[model samples]
Target chain A: MSEHTTLSDLEAAIDNTFATDAQQASVDVVEPGIVTAVETLSMQQALNRALAEVLEENPKALVLGEDVGLLGGVFRITDGLQKQFGEDRVFDTPLAESGILGMSVGLAMAGYHPIPEVQFDGFAYPAINQIVCQVGRMNYRSRGTMPMPITLRVPSFGGIRAPEHHGESLESLFAHVPGLKVVSPSSPNEAYHLLKHAATRPDPVIFMEPKSRYWQKGPVDTSADGYSPEGSRIVREGKHLTLVAWGAMVARCLQVAELAAEDGIDVEVLDLRWLKPIDAEGLAASVAKTRRAVVVHEAPLTSGLGAEVAALITERCFGTLRAPVERVTGFDVPYPSGDLEDEYVPNIDRILFGIQRVLENRRG
Target chain B: MAEISFPLPDLGEGLIEATVLEWLVAEGEQVERNHPLVEVETTKSAVELPSPQAGKVVKIYGGPGDTIKVGDPLIVFEVPDDTAGIVGTVPKEEAPRRRVRLTAALDDED
Candidate 1:
């Protein structure tokens, strides 16, 4: 009786410093194996885990690529696939990039959910003909009467110290193509769910696996509970600036966000999973709060998707912008040698520099 | 004579075409199972394709620098009909494999 009477007093004594669930709801799981619950894996391992789970859940899901079946891929993302799924289901393809994409187009037309690997970003150039003209446009051309439920996987971005054209961030090229949905997961968790989502999408999707972040591990809910590619994830909410990025750049932006935190700069981070139909509304809202923004990517600064994002932000939130949008991106020159990739790829300091520029503009 | 045709296998990371860099065996040359048949370079890396069935090479479909797609006829071997003891010896499945399509129910839309 005494304790019951003292309950209100104890409640009143509580600090109430910790935030409650009222702030944000728990994560919603779309599919059972959509996310990894425990130990995080490298981006590559995360993709492999997701593919294994997806193939297990859906017998129709097939993985086709060069060296992916037996050699486990040059990056080893598809290691042991041939043995587990048998040579028939997870075998290697010919060296023709266009043939791979064209065959995938036909496979999707024939009702196959094909996930074809382009091997590398530079190599993906050859497949662009098939992807841009046929694979990307087939479904729209048929006006939904036909769907190319194919996922074109390419490991893109610089910073892995790859030689020559191996590390080019050619996202702009894919983004320019209609009927193709481009996406990149910046971390292991996003990689797991995004790949699953890409595999399941009805239209052809260009899944650019960030080869640079292939080995970085993070939290993943492998229990299959995760978000969809259609949604833009808010990594951090800020009242000062909105930092929008994807794939490897997202990770760099997050680091910059951490640095900004040290300087009392509250910056919101937006991870755009689906690059084609981006979460424009959500991004505008973030910019409206911050009144400033910085768009970043590994692709060249000239016509990268960041340019499109900058345009969209200004169009949607013109009055809200405290300053013009800034972009931190790769240079226009060809991807340099492995030794010079560090300078080519945008990093924490570069992103921070962008934030500083935007903040200064806001002050001015 | 039993005909052993080597239809190109999926090289894994979804390669569709490969360039034949070198032929390890000449037409009419005898080869053993798992012997390196040809060196093919795809988009990612260069690899040596192994002979599935041990026999005499009757024909080579792709020459050096010639590009070929998966499921294309790689080689035609005059395999002996004496024994079908080869484990991985798959009869030429098809000239070009029909696309392996995933059913609609399994198609996961975003």
Candidate 2:
């Protein structure tokens, strides 16, 4: 053998090159759902488009939240909406989370589609009782006689380094409560369509907004069908490791996939947009091919959606997995302050660590 | 004097305090009823508060970045004597008041 083929020669060439394993994997392919030339719009703008479109389409749809009237909401998501629709239709409410949601349940019972913005993730805790007891169970309580067609737009997640309650991933809390449909949009595109879908759905939806990703630009076709909020869209596909995430974490996982490519790991990223009725079949199929799974989210690790997903994966794809399912999530402590949050959140490194752990188990 | 009390409106989602993002009306500025008078930033979104009375803005209670509580006076207005007579008696075009609850701020948690 030539000296150029020596072990040291191979080590010298490979040691300096940092390529991710995902980069080496096959390109993700799926039926391109729908595409419309969408402009670069902020999260608020996309939401406005969706709301405006829905209101125009459905006369029964009403937008309510704190300061949604002439103030147009705190984030201005409802800006100009009242002006266009009139104050009688789009109005503000007394500041009470439970009241906002409870009134919405009442209005929905009266055949109006009440869309209330909880304003912030942590702020929604007070309304948990209304959501769990009333909004969640209203349908079953009515025995199909009434439909609680209400949508709660909750702006959540971290990365802005905001205060404690400002950046919380509380999806698991709502997901655990039956009868509540949870849908989190990872980009502007999803924000527009999913909101439209959620507005029309016959059940109440906990629409989680990744507050930090409110400005991230993506294609939002107000005219296209790809942005269905009711269905989960597979963002990427691979046959080695499945990275299932939602909201802002989906973008984080995509970044992790780029880093993972250098390590020769093929990761399939699934955007679990609708978390309540999770796209279990889609997730199961991906895990089956990869034989490994890593569920990632920003919520605290204890009883987080990751745990639920891991359980679901184990239950559905246990035979296909060569390694036990893994999870990458935040610590169990309260969402740390902005400065300490970086240490608490699950980043690309954490995701890679989870993938490595799962892959290592398979190797052994 | 039209005691234009800009009570702190509910900032929504239990947001008690909001940063005064901007002042749409300055002191002594003539504002029409229902015109925007101030901008406040809460955790949820930024909202432009409408003026409750159409008159000269007498004073602003809070400056930018100050967090005001719900029901706290936000601004005052100098109304014409005719309008002054009906200040608290009649609910003359009462602007919506957002409800604010006493809750521990995020930092207050141990």
Candidate 3:
């Protein structure tokens, strides 16, 4: 900083930094294979443990959000963290998503890793300015000198019969932004590891926590390696068709896959965990094997993340695909409140019907 | 120059209150941080509570079997103005007896 500098010189330096970065390998993920000693944990407990570990493992990391400290979040995803990590490392913040995220940007620029929560998916709207203009752009905007090591948590998606704005899906919006890595973990196991992995990366990660799945219990292998930032995960193996999904929809797809099996229909379920950087290769591979695909998401169908996945599938698996990629998504309308949510969210029967559509539309 | 109050912190496992089992340090006795100040029995088990900072004990509230709430003042102390009985002390002409913000800064780990 003391050296004399010009705009051209800074641009040259920035170009050099990016060149090195492009050649640099992506984040190294430990492949903890066959972890057997796992504890049964709800998605909430797993997320809590992940944050606790982040604070404990990195002295530079902290957690901030509304009711995150004493109340432990509306979903209690951060329960007992304040006591375990102390108020300094884990504390509540004012009920302003923009302020919380703005503080995170400042803190990250100051060399602190901050995990700020938006409380609910809809709550992120107020913070869109900070998220898009600052958090996602700081690194590139600063010529790679000011990478934001932030994990912005958003308790997302539908199903617990909550009111409007409480059950919104914003994955499409987050993934569309440049420089933001969007990830949504569909289960307790994925939630535990993906969160830990997201917190460690030197970029901002939009961590979409499926709210309805928070209380569902599943085995979490702590010692297991976290999911790689590279691609989607194949949760079930089948040869007939692949059900591409993430978040709460993954569970619903799995159930539909089971039901599809009884009707002499074998299906594969692929959880597209990482929304941005869409894991095009993995999607192509899964669809290449199955030859048919149906994407399921909670967002509206018009320009939802499912459309992007469908396009990626078409681009890479066109010849191998026996049918065009189909999407079973929410209708193009505002996410309604409870009492109408059951019809709004894609259910098992709707997904099965979508699967049947793909099965019927044979591309000879 | 300052009277510092010590509230019973929530011990792990979500215990809200603890009954005084015994007093290990008498009033007016000087004790260092982490020194056993009193023994208390919770619903789970009996455990000794430690002095949070180095100070002269000015008063000890409650007797044996008396219950103390999680945030209730359990003891008070008298400490020098400069030597504030709390973490993250700053030099001030009139320093209030309060714990400073917890931080993870390299030299200021708390």
Candidate 4:
């Protein structure tokens, strides 16, 4: 294939994988079969289906953001939602992130579960004041009398060659703020369930989507099962090292675990689905078993979400750890251009290096 | 040589069918494992299906623009007995690796 053809072909393959997964996911939700019948779906499609389901079940739920109405969002996460739910329920607002969020807070105050989409992670900076100050603190401010049911969706993380400010992994920033539940789903199954859970909650939630994994496909059981997004889960069981990650990095960790297996090292993978109010107990249990831990993320290392996770692990599993916790993360620099993104983002080699560092420090 | 019928694999979650956009390889053409075989588009994105093993394309299933279901056979590959494990048996590791951007700026190696 020509260079141009190859590039586009690669892009197409990624897109096709997500699309096919979404199609399969629809089957599970709509088809009448055994409750265990699972369907594959891309992360993006799963989120879309979750939004559709939320609007369908909850009449008070409203979805609004720039292009969410006619354009169906930049990534089309809200595609056909307006048509299904009408212009009032799924509509667009001014291109102001702060305004969108501020309005969501007001709507929530009026008893509406407002699910607003902040077009991109970088663009969310404009609305950080509202998110951090009002949306996050409203329930606490009211002394439990009032609850803010706003699920702000921000498509985040690097990779996919997006422009500056488009691929920011700002989950750490939100998780630092008090009273906000921060969630980052890694797969279609988690994305589908976690989004629904976020919408149903009485508190404000920052639903960070790893934009890079929008097209990543996986199996999803849409059988009205009880899957809570409240805590972390050990996705893969191993005894050598514990890999803690969320969003896109979970897949990377799983891949690293596979590579580590080649070297006879058993790696347990933990998906920290909920960033804020992290499952400290679950994380501690996994670390206690493995005795070595490595935190991974697409965000920059300094004060990233990984730092909080590492601190938690160190504090809880201090006596059990065999070595110092290592972190595999993006460099502490502005997200690089598309051409140099691979260099900026963590990959298999970097994660392996982290595992190796922990192993080298293992107590004899 | 045994014939392996390569069906359209699940492209992503919930995808039941896809439309053939283009054929990268032709019937009677030789292909190696992981070679691009066809381009298919679903509702989400365009994807290129790769060959599972080294073989000669014995038959092509659907023409461009034809919609094929998940289990529909897309290609028939004639391969040696040892290579005939299953069609669309591309290893998970063969999938595209995420390029790790060099962190020279972060390193102290001047």
Candidate 5:
């Protein structure tokens, strides 16, 4: 039998044997229809609503992951989805990461949009082969004849003290890869809209969720057109230095900017929501105005996504820069134990240090 | 009533110690099966440990900022013999029921 046939048979056997009626009944069904009013929701809840909205509007979209069906995902982001959508659309799969990505590619090839959750940042390693080789290359390899619409959900970043492999800032790996679009949201409002955009886009998107900010709440305007993933947002505007960050670090940068303001230094904070197709122009513009720049992230310093942003700012705003771009990031080591994690991960002090370095280097 | 001690569980691989972040249930308070008893910050993540069975919070082992190792006593609960199977034995049906209720609550908010 063909490899696809074998996988299909295996999936069929697992579904037939394990997916019971009681499991379906056990999952609660949320009332249909999207919430239109402005409401405060945690990042997790906002992402959940975004997933539900996508599944509601697009019949071709389906969610599949381990514990996604009956358990509603480990983070409960997929809660109430299986019951509303049914087994075929929102079903659980065996604990095989490679199979998950491979099957998603096949599903996309068959004209279906599949949003598969990796469950955690570390678990994604097993499926890296499929993600980098197949999913990222399919559309270009097909000479534009094939369109792959797949959103891989990854819960990432530290600060929650999650054990090994659970808290990682691995977006840099995917961002370096050519065909995938990497997007991370720092707030609930951004999570809702960016998720909607990622789901609807006709390309593969690695949606990294900053797990530390999962419970961080903010107002989400459901009626507004969710911002496009093509550009960056100037969340806080200032004149002395540009603070560029995304995911969980955005909040940290804002806090750093607030602290800088008390010292009479106005810092402009830019959130690079889209990683792969980074907003080079917008970032350059921000740096040009501020004349100094600092990039912050929880990932390590060497070749981290922050390095790429720093390089881009250098390339675009070289003539206008008063100081070299500085990066604030985790050390170049494996994420340490919980006791040492606070020191390992970049905090407000480290970010402020970066800001201070750029300011000290500023041309008088 | 018999008092049972619940130890801090290993949240994930190689987690040695965790900080007691907050007490979800205070001492002398009644808690139902599966109700969250305490929130602890481990190396992996911040997790709320649920009460294993219906009981009264007889004593909490640590205060906020106290570091607790895996297998260290976390909470002490007093429970009647009939309801206490073990320190943390939650009813099988209660898990799904809680999920359903959470979904219902979110739906109401929507």
Candidate 6:
């Protein structure tokens, strides 16, 4: 030890720790069957099964995060994975979001597909540096020669009634990043397929799983079915007005549509699955048919994802639109704790009112 | 020998009942603590209930698709007389933030 450490002194100490020459091992990753059977699964089970299938199909794919391996994740989305995949493939890292993502960047560069979990949406703040600086830019920095095939899973949105830092709606932040592709699945079937597809992409994908909808059951036709993971889809069709939403809000919009039907309002529910690389064509077509639009989300109003959806609709369907696009979203404030969540999140009544705003608006 | 009944627990806040999806362990079989006993689908999520303690399965009260109330007996086990004590549902005021630990945050199965 020295009173003042010099650069050369530090370099010499690091050099003494290990050999200078690097020994790189070749990785042979094999792709197995994705999925084939049609069955019912809760969103939690579907996400878990999707990760299992991803590991089974791709030998190079690795799952790592805080409590992800040994604890199967706080949400149990990766339950039983450590036992099935062995420690080398599915392992836990310390409670460090930045380190987890930094490790993913290094692993991805070394020819391995890393699927890292951030544990919670609020926890992702620490990893912003690695995500923005390395994961999203490495491929471009290397001129497409080095592609970062990383799918970072984040359990997002509120409704779990957990304490502070447990629930967050972070799609807008991730979507704002230039090089990241964002996708949120509303159902078990979409979760299964989207996760499988997202893992195979060459670019980085921010896979946001709606925490609240993780247990909602739905039929998943595992054998290559209708919906593609790249764009949005009209889950429920109507001709009067369109309700655009993603994640947990999609289900809420569906409920609103059901209630609006009693009042002769034919509301169409469109699940905007992919937040980044926004589906311009799909949004245009859906709103064009209905001639009116209302965007719903759990995120706050100022700079929320709903604003983007409304802007996209306005840009794409301005000529055909009968009324201004409405946004029904959480109030502009920090997301509150469990007791106040019901008031913060957009409920059936809030969405219905947004629908009314659009439906009642006239050219005058 | 002593017989003890384990009631279906309320998996989530305000959940009153759940539909039995399956019984992982059958009656007349030996089981250990933490062994998954049954799967039930509540309004919130589908979760497996683990054995409260090591014992012989004496009886199971509910079948698949059967609705079991939160405090109703779901299973029964026979244990050595000396080891038996109060088994289920600590009053709300006395309960800790967490009591069950076999989950995958569903508690540590350790």
DockQ of every candidate: 0.02, 0.03, 0.01, 0.03, 0.03, 0.03
Question: By lDDT, is 2 or 5 better?
Answer: 5
Which stretches of candidate 4 lie above 4 Å from their native place? A1-36, A362-364, B1-110
Docking quality (DockQ) of candidate 6: 0.03
Candidates 3 and 5 compared: the better one by TM-score is 5
lDDT of each: 0.75, 0.75, 0.81, 0.80, 0.80, 0.80
lDDT of 5 by residue, A1-364 (tens): 3656787665544343212223221213334565578999978789999998888878888999988886577777887899899999998999999999999999988878899998888899999999988888776666555666889999888876667887788989999886788999989999999998888777789999988787667998887665455689999999878899999889877877777666667789999999978999999889888788988888988999888998999999999776788988889999876667779887777677677666667321
lDDT of 4 by residue, A1-364 (tens): 4756777676654333211212211212333344565789877678888899888778889999988886567676787899899999999999999999999989988878899999888889999999988887776666454567789999888776767887679988998887688999998999999998888777788999887777668898887576766789889999778999998889888987887776778789999999988999998999988888999988898999888888899999998777888988888899887778877888788887787777777321
lDDT of 1 by residue, A27-133 (tens): 23336533334875767678888888667666666889877776567676776677788887787999989888888888777667788888888998788788888
Which ranges in model 2 have alpha carbons more than 4 Å from their true place?
A1-36, A225-230, A362-364, B1-110
Model 5 scores what on Cα lDDT? Answer: 0.80
Query: Can you tell me the DockQ of model 3?
Result: 0.01
The digit string of per-residue lDDT tens for model 6 on A1-364 reads 5789899776655443221123122335465545577899988789988899888878889999987876567667787899899999999999899999999999988888899999888999999999988887775565445667889999888887777776688889988876788999999999999999888777789999988777678999888656677789999999888999999888877777777776767789999999998898999999988888888888888898888898989998898887899988888888898889878998776666666666667321
Specify the poorest-scoring 10-residue window by lDDT in model 2 chain B. B101-110
In angstroms, give how far residue A258 of model 6 lies from its true place: 0.7
Q: What is the TM-score of chain A in candidate 2?
A: 0.87
Stronger candidate by lDDT (1 vs 5):
5
Better of 1 and 2 by TM-score: 2
Which digits, one per residue and each the tens of the lDDT, describe model 2 over residues B24-100?
88898999989998899888899988877688887887888888887787887776433442211211222322222
Q: Quantify how close model 2 is to the true structure by its C-alpha RMSD in Å.
A: 19.6
